[model samples]
Target: MATTILETCRVPAPPGAAANLSLPLTFFDIQWLHFHPIRHLLFYDYPCSKPYFLETVAPKLKESLSLTLRHYLPLAGNLIFPLNSEKKPEIQYVAGDSAVSLTIAESASDFDHLTGNHARDADQFYEFVPEIDPVTDESEYQRVPVVALKVTLFTGRGICVGFANLHCLGDASSVVGFIKAWASISKLGGDEEEFLTKHAESLPILDRSVINDPLGIDTIFWKVIRDVPLKSSSFPLPTNRVRATYILRQADIEKLKDLVLAKKPGLLQVSSFVVTASYVWTCFVKSEEQVDDDDVLQVFIFAADIRARIDPPVPASYFGNCLAYGLAKIEHKQLVGGEGFVIAAEAIADQIKNRLNNKDQVLKGAENWLSETKEMTAIRAFGVSGSPKFDLCSADFGWGRARKLETVSIDGEKHSMSLCKSRDSEGGLEVGISLPKARMDAFAAIFEEGLRF
Candidate 1:
């Protein structure tokens, strides 16, 4: 697919939002300071004239986004690490003229194939996602935009809205909230002030002080990230890398859960996540025949939300990162063994349970784990990224809900999968997996055969 940029302009926040403003970063936010920005693209099939979109749809989207930024002003700001200040890095919102970059473009790709459920070239989707330039020099305070957007027109078919946001600003929950609010404003189509006032409850809370870090994890996290070199985004993927989406119907999910339970009748928790994740992990490991080595270790790492787990529970809508890492390590032989799926399920479930039940201990362990494994990377790791709880398909932008939603950012990372609620709303699950072209066929076979068993 080829994309041609038509125009690029800055969309600033509403009036009075352009003053020098700074919001302190919480420990939760500090943890993700060095992580890559989140990239998401929502596809819609408009089948309308481009003229109509330019005159009506595009205007409303831009205006709604501008109004939306009033509530989410931090997104229109910059993240800075001050050299002279003793405090941690903060996001500075500058008023007057500073704005979020919005790029309007056109693509020549097949809209149907791009939005279809089947797998396609992962590289094609890259053109739809906007880039957020990172600050390279850390000597002095440098300004970097927290968000950027691109809206690509597919000529006569539809449009794709690509959004990019810094990880330190918020988590998946915050991103969903912001998108929904923008869509609601676009659908209402009236006085922006009255709309915001009417939907006042949708606004996010920016007070980082509410997140009390009694253990001083923020300082430790900063120290750890400061010493580590920033990761380059230009890393090349294997020549044969491919991306595909696999759907596990409700019946398939139940069957997998039953299979795991049948193996170990004493096992009490075989939730959908455990069953689904374990099945995918097993398939991945089995596809790589090299995992048969007894000395090799396979690790599974995932993040669990700590908003409700923390003392004085943070609100579900609390803006910023609030997650703890869950790690499970096992020998390669044990994972590829006959009862691999069952064992994997138990391990993942136990890790999640421990993190939830022992929040403080898990946080400390994560801190220590990061401190010890400074040289290790995710090349040999397997984990899940998106959550079924996010319900991404429901996001409507006046026209209708998205025909397809994808986490294109995961394409660069190996052995990482994206999960979300199925579009049918039938309690099923959608799993997006990326792998080498040679292994995809094997992975698909194992994935299907394991479920059948």
Candidate 2:
């Protein structure tokens, strides 16, 4: 395959170390693939070893060995986690796919090179190697391996710090360039990064047609507000990384259903976005801004399992993008309407019904949000995950069930939000939520109040 020309430069010194691929995540590492270490993990490194990432993508990808693998085949839609939930998740090797089968470990050590079985031993997985700058003799970059251990195993502070992979998965090619640039600087003696980044921000914040939430950043807006998925939108993946997983809880789900019941029927049977909506509002949708008549809008967006919701459930293992929208947008007054929790419940439910039931529309209008090309139109977007056909509750490793599972996200100049589910000490569900620092503080306060109400 041919290569494209990406911007390159000497690595920066001292304060100007080259930026490496910022992605990080330990997929099979946590939740151990449906809570069973026996299941396979298609582990992959950051696609950061390449040069000319921005420019030569087409050529390299054309010549890429994976092209020999198979077409861009979407994974199965109805296939639940743990393949067999009652047991651990395991995938037999299949030929002709870029995705690979993970070899299970008798213990987690199979995944990480660490000493002793100490909780901190997982730290070795995050060991970043430094890249020397081309300009300065100083190593201009340090790409530490990421910590893929369970967040619950760590403090709130630690999970808060695990944003690197999130950034990487969001854009893998960029990750490739970043790491290569760093490697070049670290080993080739160049500026830490293509000088553009160092001088780019200082140059200007160009204003254009793009609009954003009041917070003025894309990630922040996605944090608290729920978003719906586009027809082709992907499940959570890091900015520049490849692997990802989606996990939820059973009991908290019970709490969600109860909240929705106050308003509409067929809710528990509604889309996952519907279930997630109640949690989003109950946790923090209370009038952060109401004076200007701008009632807080919690836009919930996620895919509806169109395959199953319409009628008989799709085959237990049916795969493909058989999903539609569970889109809903509610105003704060209506969300916290005077009628009480019952009122709030009904209003949000009504909002979801309005979207899903409207004009035979599911995305409400988000089509290009997941576009693969620039020519693709950009759809107006809302944040909410669609419902899943797979069983999140049953994802068990040989150890029983995943003690904890989080829909990992990465933070940048902006931030992201994902879900987490931990097994109860007694082997049930314990849900945990993570958002931007600014918002999480507010969420804690609301959780305190939610428990009261």
How many residue pairs clash in all the candidates, one count each?
A: 3, 72
TM-score of each prediction:
0.92, 0.40
Off by over 4 Å in 2: 1-276, 287-296, 310-316, 336-344, 351-382, 385-394, 410-422, 425-432
lDDT of 1 by residue, 6-56 (tens): 778888887766476688887778777776777888888777677787788
Task: Give one digit per residue, the lDDT tens place, for model 2 in 1-453.
Answer: 111112222111122212221111111111111110111111212122123322343233222212211211111001112211122211111222113111111112232222111122111222211111111111321121111211111111111001122121212222222222222232222332343344333221111121112332223222212122112112232323212222234554566566556555655344344455455544555524233564645454443333333333333223122344444446656655543344444545565566544434533333333322121113222343212223232232111232233233221102223333233323122333334344455655665565445
Each model's Cα RMSD = 2.4, 19.7
- C-alpha lDDT values of all predictions: 0.78, 0.29
Off by over 4 Å in 1: 84-87, 134-139, 190-199, 227-240, 359-362, 372-379
Cand. 2 Cα-lDDT: 0.29
* Candidate 1: 10-residue stretch with minimal lDDT: 230-239
> What is the C-alpha local distance difference test score of candidate 1?
0.78
lDDT score, candidate 1, position 389: 81
Show the lowest summed lDDT stretch of 10 residues, model 2: 152-161
Best-performing candidate as measured by TM-score: 1
RMSD of 1: 2.4
Best by lDDT: 1
